[model samples]
Target: MHDDLIPFNKPFFVGKELFNIAQAVLNGTIAGDGEFTRRCQAWLEQHLGTPKALLTHSCTAALEMSAILAGVGPGDEVIMPSFTFVSTANAFVLRGATPVFVDIRPDTLNIDERQVAEAITAKTKAIVAVHYAGQPCAMNALREIARNHGLMLIEDAAQAILSGDRGSSLGTLGDLGCLSFHETKNVISGEGGALLINNPELIERAEIIWQKGTNRKAFMRGETSKYTWVDIGSSFLPSELTAAFLYAQLEHAKRINSHRRTLYLKYFELLAPLAEQGHIKLPALAQDKPANAHLFYILCRDANERQALIAHLDSAGISAVFHYVPLHDSPAGFRYARAHGKLQVTTEIANTLLRLPMFSEMTTAEIRRVCGEIDVFFKITSKQPCELS
Candidate 1:
C-alpha cells in the first residue's frame, strides 16, 4: 500500500490502551472474564442500557450465542436481509436453521418490516434486524410484529454502536443485540464484539453460553458450590488484552462517533450537488433514527458505473469497495437459506452501492479529495461537468 493511499478503514487509539494492558498483566489476569473484561461489559451495559452485556471474540460469536438462546433448530426458519454480512445467516445456519432472506427498504437499506410479516410462518422462529450503516431499522414495527408472532427479535447491530431509534439505543431495543468492534468500525478493538441481552429470562443462559457452557460465573460469584460443564457452548469470551484495548476505545466512543458523523456530513455536503443532478444518490437516513455514522456510501447509476468508480478511486490511491454478493445469490445461501420474496430492492442496492473511505480520524480534506475524484469520474463518464454549487 502506498503511503499516500487513503485506506477504507483505520484503527485508532484514544488513550490508556497499552497502559491498561500492562495493568491487566500486572493484575495477573489476562484470561477471559477478567478485570478488563468486566469493565468493558459494565461500560456497555451502562451506556446501551441493556440488562446484560457479554464480550465475545467477534460479532460472529455474539450472533452464534443469540442463535442458541433463541432455541432455533433444524427446520426452523430465521428471517433477515440478504444484503448483510454472512454471519447474520451463518450463525443460525450453523445450528441447522434455514435463513429466510427478505428484502430491504430502498431508503435505509435495512430489512423491510412490511415484508417481514408476510414471510412469517409456523416454522419461523426468529427475526434478525441488521442495522445497515449504523442506521436503525423500523424497530417499533418490527418489535410489534415479533410480539404478535411470538418470535424472538435479534438485532444485528454490528455497525450500530451508540445509535438510537426514537429515545432507545439500537442494541437494547431487541431481545438480543450484537455489536462489532472490528477495526473498520467507528469504535474498534482490532477484532471484538458484544452480545446485549435485554430479556431477563435469557440472561442466565447467556452468561452460561458466554463461559463455554458452565456455571463458572455463578461459581465465581459464590452462588454455587462448584462450576461444571452443564450445557452446550464455545469459548466465546475475548481475552483481557482485547477487553483492555476495547475499554480504552469505549471511553472515547462518543467523541469518536461525533467526529465520524462530522466526516459523514462533509461527504454528503460535498457530493450533494451530484446527487441533486442525478449523477449519484446520497444516503437517506430517517429523521428519528440517528446513526453512529459507521460508514459513508453512495449509489451509482449501475453495477458497471460502481465498478468503474471503484477502479477510478483505486487509481487515485483511494480505497473504495462493495460487499455482500447478496447472500441469497451465493452458493452457501443456496444450500442453507431461501428467499422469501422477489427481493427486488435488495438485488438493486447490491448492484449499485459503493462504500467510500471512512474512519474516525479522517480529515475533511481527505473527504474532499475522495468526493473530487467522484466528481471527476462522473465528468469523464457522462461527458459533462456536474454543477458543484
Candidate 2:
C-alpha cells in the first residue's frame, strides 16, 4: 500500500520556509511580536483590508479571542453550522455561551442564511459564519440578519485566507474573522492563525487580549508607560519562527493558489462524467465570488456507496476520507450546544461526502489515477450481485 501512495493532502513548500525560519532565529527574537511577526500581521491587515490583524497560535485561539471580544457570556447563544470543525463551536462553548447548531446549504456547504435568521433568539449574541471549504457563506444575507437582530457577525475564515465573496475578502466581511495557516491550508506555517478585527472599536481591546490581557502592544509602541493585565485572556501569539515561515509562504501565495486552482479545475474536468452520469456530485463554486481551492470533495449516492468508494480508493493505494459528523449528534456538542432545526442536509453530506487527494504539489497523473479509481469502483459495483433483487 505504501508503494506509489498518494496522500489525501500533501503540504506544499514555496522554497523559502526553512531559510526564513533560520533568519527569524538569527534575528534573536524567536518568541513573538518580533520583526517577522509584525510583518506578517501588517501584510494580512493590508491585504485583507482589516483594521487590525494579530497572529495567533491557531485558528481555535483566534476564535476563542473572538468569543472574548464579542462578550459572549453565560446564557448568551451563538449560531453556527453543524458541519464545521469543533473549534468553531468550542470557542464560544468555553466562554459558557450556547452554540446553536444549524444546517448548511447543499451547494456551498455553508451555513444556511435563512435558517440563521430563524435561529436567532433574545439571548443570541453572535453569528459565526464558517466559510466551508473556502467557499464563502452568504455574507450579505448573514450581515443583514446580524444587523437586524443586533448580533455580532464573526467570520470563521480558517480555510479562506486568500478567498473573497463578491468584492470583499472573506476575513473582512464580519465583525471579527479568523484565519488558519495549518499544513492543509492554501498558505501555511505548520500551525498558525490570525485574528482579523474589522470593527475599529475592537482593535484596542483585541491587542490587549492578544497580549495576554496586558497592554504590552501599547507599551512596545511607547504609548503606555507600563503594561499590566486589564482583561481575561491567554497566550495567543505565535512564535516569530512561525510568522517567518508564514511570511515566506505569503510572498508566493499567488503562485501557490494558481497552481492549486489548476488542480481543482482538472479534478472538475475529470469528474464531470461521474457527475453527469449520476454516480457522484461535485461542489458548485459560487457564481459571484472566488475560492482559494482549499479542498476538493465528491458526494456518493449514499453512505454505503461512499464507504465502498473509499475502500476502492484505499485498495488502490490512495487516501480518501470523510469530513465532520453533525455537531448536533456529537457528545461534546450535545453537552455544550442546542440544535436549531432538523439538520437534513448536514447529516446527508456527512455520510455521503468523500474528500479526494488534493494538493498544490499533486500532479496531473495523480489526479487521473484518483479519477480512474472512482470509475473502476462504480464499474465493479455495477457488476456485483444484488443481495435483495
Candidate 3:
C-alpha cells in the first residue's frame, strides 16, 4: 500500500488506551473479567440500558454464546440475511443448526423482515438481525415476528454501537445482542466484542457462558462457595489488556460516532448529484433510525462499474473496496446453509456495492478527494457527466 493513500480504514485512539493497559498490568490481573473488563461491561450496560453486557474476544464469540443461550442445536434453524458476514451464520452452524438465509431489503440492504417471517418453520429457533453499516434493521417488525413465533431474537450489531431505532439501542432491542470493537469499527479495541442480554431470564446463564461454562463470576462476587464447569461454553471473554484498550474507546464513543457521522453525511452530500442522475445509489437513511456511521457505501450500476470505480480510486491514491459476497452462494453456505427464496436482491447488492474510505479520524478533505475521484470515473465512463459540487 502507498504511504500517502487514504486506506479503507485506519484504527485510531481517542483516550488513555496505553495508560489503561499499563494500569491493568500494574493491577496484576491481565486475564479476563478483570477491572478493565468490568468497566467496559458497565459502560455498555449503562449506555445501552441493557440488563447485562459481557465482553468477549470477538463478535463471533458473542454470537456463539447467544446460540447456546437460545438452545439452538442440531435440527434447529436460524434465519438471517445472506448479505451479512460469515460469522452471522457460522455461530449457529457451529452449534449444528442450519442457517436459513434470507434476502435483504433493496433500500437498506438489511434483512427483509418479511423474508424472515416466510422462512420460519417448526424447526426455526431464532432470528438474527445484522444491522449492516450500523443502520438499524427493521427491529420492530422483527421483534413482532419473533414474539408471534416464540423464537429468540438476536442482533448481530457488529457494525452498530451507538446506532438506534425509535429511540432504543439496536443491541438492546433483541433477546441477545452482539457488538464488535474491531479496529474497523467506530470503536477501536484491536479485536474485541460484547454480548448484551436483554431478556432477564438469560442473564445468569449468559454470565456462565461468558466465563467458560463456569460459575466463576458468582464465586467472584462471593455468591458461590466454589466455581466449576456447570454448562456448555467456551473461553469467550477477552483478556484484560483487550478490555483496557476497549474501555478507552468506549469512553469516547459518542465523539467518535459523531465525527464519523459527519464524514458519512459529507460523502452523501458530495455524491447526491450522481445519485440523482442515476449514476449510483446511495445508502438509504432514516431520521428515526439513526446510525453510528460505522461505514459508508454506495451501489454502482453493476459489478463491472464497481470494479472500475475501485481501480479509479486506487489510481488517485484513495483506497475503496467492496463488501461481502452473498453467503448463500459460497461453498460453506452450500454445505451449512439454505436460502429461503430466490435472493435476487442479495446477489445484486453483493455484486454492485462498493464501500468507500470511512473511519473516525478521516478528514473532510479526504472525503472530497475520494468523492472527486468517483465523479471523474463516472465522467470518463458515461456520455453525460455529473459534476461534484
TM-score list, all predictions: 0.97, 0.97, 0.97
Q: What is each predicted model's overall lDDT from 0 to 1?
A: 0.92, 0.90, 0.91
| Residue 271, model 3, lDDT | 96
lDDT for residue 311 in candidate 3, whole number 0-100: 89
Candidate 2 lDDT (Cα, whole model)? Answer: 0.90
> 1 or 3: which has the higher lDDT?
1
* Candidate 3: regions farther than 4 A off: 1-3, 288-290, 383-389
Among all windows of ten consecutive residues in candidate 3, which has the lowest summed lDDT?
380-389
The lDDT leader among the candidates is 1
Kindly report which residue pairs in candidate 1 clash with one another: none
- 1-389: candidate 1 lDDT, tens digit per residue: 55788999887889889999999899998999999999999999998899999999999999999999999999999999999999999999999999999999998999999899999999999999999998999999999999999999999999999999878899999999999999998788898999999999999999999989999999999999989998999999999999999999999999998888889888988998999888888899678323888988898778888899999999999999997799999999999899998899989889989999998878999999999999999888874433311
Q: How far does residue 113 in candidate 2 sit from its true spot (Å)?
A: 0.4
> 179-246, model 3: which lDDT tens digit per residue?
99989989979999999999999999998988888999899899989989998889998999999999
Q: lDDT rank, highest first? A: 1, 3, 2
Clashing pairs in model 3, backbone N/Cα/C closer than 3 A = none
lDDT of 2 by residue, 194-286 (tens): 999999999999999998899898898999899799888789999998999999999888788888888888889999887877788888977
